[model samples]
Target: AKTSGGFAPFSHTVTSVTHHKGSSTVRALSMISSQSTSAEISWGIPTGSEGRKLRYIISYKCVNQLACSPGCQDAVEGRLTQENTRMTLSPLLPFTQYLVTVTPEDGLPSEIYVGTSEAVPTEIPSLSFRSPDRTNTSLTVYWEPTIVCSS
Candidate 1:
């Protein structure tokens, strides 16, 4: 049916419809250890998935059931644009074992990386020093928060 600024009616029968969206084959996985209660993860874009729009889904949980107590289910899930392949999960239980997985939109279920969060002090302690040991001391330190941080 065709319409030219007027009402038109059309009807048809369909057998089936299929979409052939491809999947990303993860080439590599890199993880940044969690300092206190988080971890950073990034992976190489799949060779075939490049230049194509996609989405990323990350699922994680505490590996040891005992750590989670009665439920032992500390699962966490998130979704992000394909461009934002890397992400950080924070506020996780400190000193806990976890299993993490990254899957593309419609990708298969799989677990590729496993890591533990760093142990943290009950409180953020201030940097303290005592009596410079009666000797002159000097130190230079550099701190970078994330990959996107400038300077």
Candidate 2:
């Protein structure tokens, strides 16, 4: 009924509204962080709506209890179009756990759906140096893999 942001302000009345069934699907989830901070988030739009207007919201929390609750200090809310929607959350602390929720707006009230994702670990690989002779002319280096295995 009420619209915000750069869009025009208006309200519409409907006879009846139906809440979407099942859970919201997260098409893509990622973390955007700097040298010492991280932000965990996901992006996707409600499916099976068949062109119905929708609204999406995402919430998150850090793994380290001392760090902060609601890892993402800011809240992102926006209108959904017919095409797939993508939502990028605010910056968060490094190596944290985040919970996100998405909801669609119908004529009545919006329904809530939730999901969770963890931030990728940030650990630098250790390097080793080797040389055939005392001279530094030709040296060989070995390092561990930068990626982590899930199993």
Candidate 3:
């Protein structure tokens, strides 16, 4: 139907719709270890929008069943830029599983994207000492691998 202003009226009927909207993608993710403190995470920014605003949110938890949560603990928002898209999460427990998300301000749906990193093991590798003889010396070491899963 045509409107009084000579424009086609908006309709809910089934019709062919073509949209040329752009999307955002995560480029890189990494975690930095600190001394007796929380680990730091640095996330790469998504590229596509020329000058649109962007917001970021991060969530994390321990690997233990009692400590891990379904949703994120902290929510952070900020404007999108070419240089400042990366952020750091601090004060987090050592050796814990963390889930990070990045959302951008675009007209397209599914703004939130999530990524996860395995928890760093808190315990150090066990080692044993052995001596062959008084004149000859020998050493032995043992270690374990960190376990991580992807969904």
Q: lDDT per model, in order?
A: 0.58, 0.42, 0.43
Please tell me which model should have the higher lDDT, number 1 or number 3.
1
Query: Residue 47, candidate 3: how far off, in angstroms?
Result: 2.7
* Stretch of 10 with least lDDT, candidate 3: 107-116
Q: Which stretches of candidate 1 lie over 4 Å from their true place?
A: 1-17, 65-83, 120-151
Which residue ranges in model 3 land beyond 4 Å of their true spot?
Answer: 1-22, 33-35, 65-83, 105-151
What does candidate 1's lDDT look like per residue over 2-61, in tens digits?
Answer: 688677777687699886565855556668556446778777666677686667667777
Q: Give the per-residue lDDT of model 3 (tens digit) for 54-127.
A: 55544443332222353233332233233455455555443334444444434222223222334544545443
Clashing pairs in 2: 38-92, 63-97
Q: Where does candidate 2 have its weakest 10-residue lDDT segment?
A: 107-116
- Backbone N/Cα/C clashes per model: 0, 2, 1
**Pairs with backbone N, CA or C atoms under 3 Å apart (clashes), candidate 1:** none
Query: Which predicted model would earn the best lDDT?
Result: 1
